[model samples]
Target: MPARSSSRLSPANSRIESMTVAACGGLATPAIETAIRIRLPASSASNTRFIKRSFEAVEPPLTLDEPGRMLMGMIVRPLRVYVSPVFRRIGLMLLAAVVTLASPALPAGGQDAPATPEVAVTDRVAPVWDGTYRRIRVPILMYHYVSPLPENADEYRRELTISPDTFRAHLEYLFFEGFTPISLYDLDEALLTGRELPAKPVVLTFDDGYIDHYTHVFPLLKQYGFTGTFFIITGRVDARDPNYVSWEQVGEMAAAGMDMEPHTKNHVSLQGRDYDFLVYEMLGSIESIKAHTGRQPHLFSYPVGQYDADTLAVARTLPIWRAVTTANGRYHTTDNRLEMPRVRITGGMSAPALASVLRGD
Candidate 1:
């Protein structure tokens, strides 16, 4: 007997035929023969109806001619007689391609994008400072005496004093914590050109020209290899004064790298004073310091941080470069050079507190 031909279809053969028709949009006799030879699985009649509806919605209607039209109709009639699963598979594949193309691109590293700069650990060791931002500022500390109190001297003790032990601890803390003691001249250079200071920078200043400042503080400063500024009251140097430093000591300090700037004649507040007295206080102190030390002091310290608009006006008129005030804050670029703020280091401040203040924390 001759070999019998199977009427039932298979899934694989149906998929191949459907893909060929979708790709070429036409069927020949050879294609139909090839599709029939590969046995395709039969799908449900409802599925065939759905696929036909979907195909008609997507594709333009075809017009038939004589021989090709007859062949196409015969092929589609068998496809409708036995439904095939190929159309559903093709739809799923096209849907997957669309979803993949529509999605957003992921980060190169296959993770969410970083929102901030990744600062390296090495950068933290030596921070590179650009001068654009006004974040950090130099701290200039002001002190007066280092003396233990006498039993019945409350008024004398409360003025401006720190014990020797406290002062030593403060210096040691600054030294160990990488602070470089800078002079007022160095500060002027930094202000003019935004230069990078040492890891830490601090300036030591003493006010009021007290005898104890020369007698006690100078020796300790010299021992520690540190320099400081001393603002002197010009008239009180040798005018029958037991409490103030003499002109001889002022000259000595000036010779030993310590600056001796003028702090007015009588240490009087310049706020409500007459213009003549202000001029006398301003110019007279400059003249007296020049006469004694042979070099005019270029800096000034306000008496008790008390100054008014007239005082600032007078300061602007003079050739003075900088002045110190007993203000309670860190020195910023916006600070007035004539009214520059100084952190007063007193008997109450500990080593850590002093360090914190110097670091502008």
Candidate 2:
């Protein structure tokens, strides 16, 4: 493909060109004599000179030295030669085609290219960074399983899993206590732009993209008129793991205003990984989430809450705006965005316990 020219077509010219292109089917060569021509009335010399001067005043000069601007002359010259409407229309369309061919507006990648809209999710806005950071107390509650554990579940599973009842209690407390559930994207924007959040703003984030999130937590959140963010393991979804959320479920949640972000391709730790491995894991999950959600993820969750300097550097290089860790705290700042901390929601924790944790008691 030829390189696109840097010059921009004026809006008036662009509209005219577009209409002409539509009328002519974008064909450059046609039997001009056979084509319909509407003869324009002859203008007085004074009027013609005035019109020419007006055109010159509004339109920039075209020269061979600037190929990008040369196409304008082609369309303008036709108007001066004869008062035939067909010739002028054809010239306008040819100019449009020339400009389009010379500098296509389409991206280098085809239709399926990953596009990050201004807002990652609906009912949201892009964050504005004003070269400063603000400290705020917004508790980001992190969860794993919202379902009860099996008899054979090990200590690790026991530590992570929270019963559905306990999860409901947490939501109830949040709802009744006037805590507004927000996504990480909301927090990011609020902190960056000095935007005020609702009273008692709290973030609900689910890690690992578990099926329990879709089945148990999703409905409960909807019931309370709340929203949450889910960090997903793409490999598990791809492998059709019954325990993990399928791509269909992920899409459903994303469509319902859930903030779906990437954990990693295979839930790998970012602590000691090389650049190639980091890119593969990070981009793989990011692209997969983008494909399903139609919005590129701006947040990431570190597997096992482990990361080093390389992890932070790679995250900064990618589309990632902020990342959460297993570190315990509710006080978030713009300076520590990439290493934002969360309040770990442990198994068997009650609504009162959650309240206390949020209050830093």
Candidate 2 on 68-130: residue-level lDDT in tens? Answer: 347645554554444332334345435433432332221212222232222242324567787
TM-score of 1: 0.60
Q: Which 10 consecutive residues of model 2 have the lowest summed lDDT?
A: 25-34
Task: Return the TM-score for each candidate structure.
Answer: 0.60, 0.66
lDDT (Cα, tens digit) per residue for candidate 1, span 244-327 = 887668878877888888888768899866444565577557655654565656789999889877677656555577788888
Clashes of each: 7, 0
Model 1: clashing residue pairs? 9-40, 9-41, 10-39, 10-40, 10-41, 11-41, 43-83
> Among these predicted structures, which one has the highest TM-score?
2
Model 2 CA deviation exceeding 4 Å by range: 1-125
